[model samples]
Target: MKILGIDPGLRVTGFGVIEKQGARLAYIASGTIRTPDGDLPQRLKSILSGVGEVIGTYRPDCAAIEKVFVNVNPQSTLLLGQARGAAICGLVQADLAVAEYTALQVKKAVVGHGKAHKQQVQDMVQRLLSLSGLPGTDAADALGVAICHAHSGDALKALQAFAPALGGKGLRMRGGRLVG
Candidate 1:
């Protein structure tokens, strides 16, 4: 499966593509889209177009994105959410299924800890993907999002596959486990 991951930001959105085969992951591409400073709408347009271009080029089977966290500044958080919305619009326009992950979830998946710093994530991404060098912070985060999905998506599917059976038993999944 090919997965596209996005780390959306108003100024610099990052993207990464990877192919997963069996238990291994191979990096395909990683980069940042820097929107030129100016009007907010234009910058958003750039992000939308950039993401569309990526989907067109990579043609991923699905996509994963980092969810926007509430910032200390409400305005900043709102703008970040807008950027994320633009990215989601692009993905859905291409008919791709999108999964969302929080920064804490991404960090835990990539670095084995939620409190890992950016450098730790970059290093772990490099090691996991067998890259020759570290990716930029933004790109690393995007790749981390993809890596997180690659690790967890199969388990999610497995759990979902049992949903009907569990439902027959008056049970369901909650907090990543079966419950009644």
Candidate 2:
């Protein structure tokens, strides 16, 4: 499966593509989509167009996007949401399934801790993807989102394979116990 991950922002949106087969995952490409910080509509248009180009180039099976987390300013958060919406629309238009992950979930999946530092996440991304150097921070975050989705998808597949044997509810204790 090929997955495209997006970290959306008004000024700079990061994107990463990865291919997964069974237990193995390989990085295909990664970069940032930059737009000048003048007009909001223009920026969004640029993001939509750039993301469309990526989808066209890679033809991913699915796309993963990091959900917006507002820390300080509401206005900024709103703008980020708009950018994210544009990205989602672009992917959906390309006929790719879109998955969303929270920043904490992404960090935990990539770095094993929800509060892991940016540098730690970047390091892990490089190591996991076998990249010679770290991608930009935003790009790294995008890759982390993709990695999280890959891991989660793999786990779900494993669970599904064993679900039927466990119980009709898909969660039942076997040998004198209750399993969820």
Q: Assess every candidate by TM-score.
A: 0.90, 0.91
Question: Per-residue alpha-carbon lDDT of model 2 for 84-111, expressed as tens digits?
Answer: 9989989999988888889999999999
Least well predicted 10-residue stretch by lDDT in candidate 2: 169-178
lDDT of 1 by residue, 62-90 (tens): 99999999999999999999999999999
| lDDT for residue 36 in candidate 1, whole number 0-100 | 96
Report clash pairs, candidate 1: none
Candidates' RMSD to native: 2.8, 4.9
How far off is residue 56 in model 2, in Å?
A: 1.0
